[model samples]
Target: MRQGTLCLLFSLLLLTPRVQAEEAAPSGKTAPFSLSAGSQISELQQQLKESERQRDELSKQLQTASNEHETALLGRLRQENQRLKLQLKEARATATPRLLTDQQQWFVIGGGVTLLAALCGILASGGHRKRRQWLN
Candidate 1:
């Protein structure tokens, strides 16, 4: 029974994944499985390096494209701002000058000036009376 179980296990192992080892040292002897495994590891490392290089290049290209897109947007915004400014300037230039046909503004200014003059005259006359009282 033990021999039968051993045979079954060996067959199972044979059915599993395996690498064919190369011959070593010019003799008919097969190389160790470790040699095959080590070669596979090296190949995997090389592939990983290649994939990383490709990823870096793609990232660089994406960054450059995005930068160009941003620059174009900025340029458009600047042009729009300049156009709006020019429109504003033209509107102001072509604007009609306000004529104060109503006398209300002039009346307000004249009244303020007249009140100021009256206050100054009153203060000047009051100062002279105060000097006379002090002398008395």
Candidate 2:
């Protein structure tokens, strides 16, 4: 609002002098115009100070908001980091364990293989065989 008003004041200040010089306005009108000019100058200075003050306030708020945003992001990242760590721990816990010693593990594996071989042999031997009549 102040900016527009200042622009209009500047335009009028420039144009008014030209108009008065051409028309030769009376001295009474000149005094009022000069008084209004001085008032407008003071008003413009006040508005400038107000604008500077507002700009400073806005800058402070922006700084505060940025700090808060950074803090929030940091907190979320920490939470995610903790969650991932927990997931890793749980996954490791679910992984296969070497509960049995190396020697016991080998023994179990050998026994299983032997048992399977024996089963196969037994099944093969159970099949009927053709006998020669003369040999019988």
Question: Could you give candidate 1's per-residue lDDT for residues 46-69 as a string of tens digits?
Answer: 999999999999999999999999
| Steric collisions counted per model | 0, 0
| TM-score of every prediction relative to native | 0.45, 0.45
What digit string (tens of lDDT, one per residue) describes model 2 on residues 38-97? Answer: 999999999999999999999999999999999999999999999999999999999897
Model 2 residue 21 lDDT score: 75
Worst 10 residues of 1 by lDDT: 17-26
Predictions in order: lDDT = 0.88, 0.92
